[model samples]
Target: MNCKQLQKIENYHEGKLQTEELNFVKKHLESCDECRRYLDELKSQALLLSRIKNFKPTLINPVAFRNEVLDQIQSKRNRYLVVRASRFVNSIIFILTQPITRYSFITAAIVIFGVFIFQQTIIVRKIESLEKRMGSNIVAKESGRPGRKNVDAFFKGRMEVQSDSDEAFRELLGNYRSLQIRYTVLLKMLKEKYPATYQEILKELEEAELLPENINI
Candidate 1:
């Protein structure tokens, strides 16, 4: 039979076709056993579907489900945060308590402090030497004594011709004043650190007439 006649079998079985169409499909089915079998199979499938029990779908609360999922996510995040915080605190404790770490830190601090003290001592000694030279110069200048011939040769020659002697002299005096200030600071530090040594040095300078007796050391 033709496919159109075969397709009309379900409509014919349901009494949904006009009399003329029904007669045509019936005539075709009488000659075509395949179309009759197709119609019988469709009827059997329909009867099986009708016999099955219908069940209502179970409903879900979207808000409740969303809240449950969010709670799980928040719990995971909290656990991660706690673990990270614990590791950070443990690292700090380890650094503070480790013998190697403690020793290294202490050694570095001691070295830095020692270097600072050594530098200060060197500065003080240099200032002390400069003070002695400046005092000798002052004594020579006041006594109208000539300075070293070698040292004066260069300046004396320039002074005789350049007319820059006064400026040069002022520059030299300014430098002497700056050295005096440095010496005073170092002297105060020395006195504070070693008063007996400072007093002995002062008395020696006085006896040698390098430092005036009236000046407080």
Candidate 2:
């Protein structure tokens, strides 16, 4: 059959065609097996759809259904969070309660204390060595001078004679300035790290007139 005649089969089966067009498609289908098969397939599809349309769906409130799903999801999330929090707390408590943890903490503290003591000891030794060297130099230079009345006289004579040479005096001044810079830097670090000790040192320096009374650190 022609495409136009085949296309009218659906209209014929659905009773949408005029009486004359219906009769024409009916005659064409009888003569053409392809058109007859197409009409049968279309009728079967329509019948299946009609049966599906006849079914009545069970109704539900969409808002309530959506709220119920959301509530379930929120409840699950809350339970998960609670479980995770509980696990974290339990783990912390477990570690804190363990004998090994306590021992480790004590060991760390002891090690830190020992390190601090060792550092202080080294610094004290260095200071003492520097002082001894300076004293020995002054003593050796004054060995020829008899009747050195006291330590003050010896130091005064040494200081007076040491500046006789311009080059040597300049070198001494340079070393003194360098030492002063280093001391200032160290003092600044100590002020930040140990405020109490720094305060005591500052007070001593101010009393001795080594540091200005109005200086903060």
TM-scores of the models, in the order given:
0.36, 0.44
Over all chains combined, what TM-score does candidate 1 have?
A: 0.36
Winner by TM-score: 2
lDDT of 2 by residue, 63-125 (tens): 898899999999999999999999999999999899999999999999999999998887655
> What Cα-based lDDT does every candidate model obtain?
0.63, 0.63
Per-residue error for 172 in candidate 1, Å, reads 8.4
| Residues 1-217, model 1: lDDT tens digits | 4565666887887889998998898898898888888898988987877775454455488789889999999999999999999999999999989999999999999999999999888866665554445544543443334345422332222212222354443344455655456446545765886687667656654443333222344
lDDT of 1 at 35: 88
| lDDT score, candidate 2, position 42 | 90
| Backbone clash pairs in model 2 (N, Cα, C under 3 Å; residues 3+ apart or in different chains), count | 0
lDDT of 1 at 41: 91
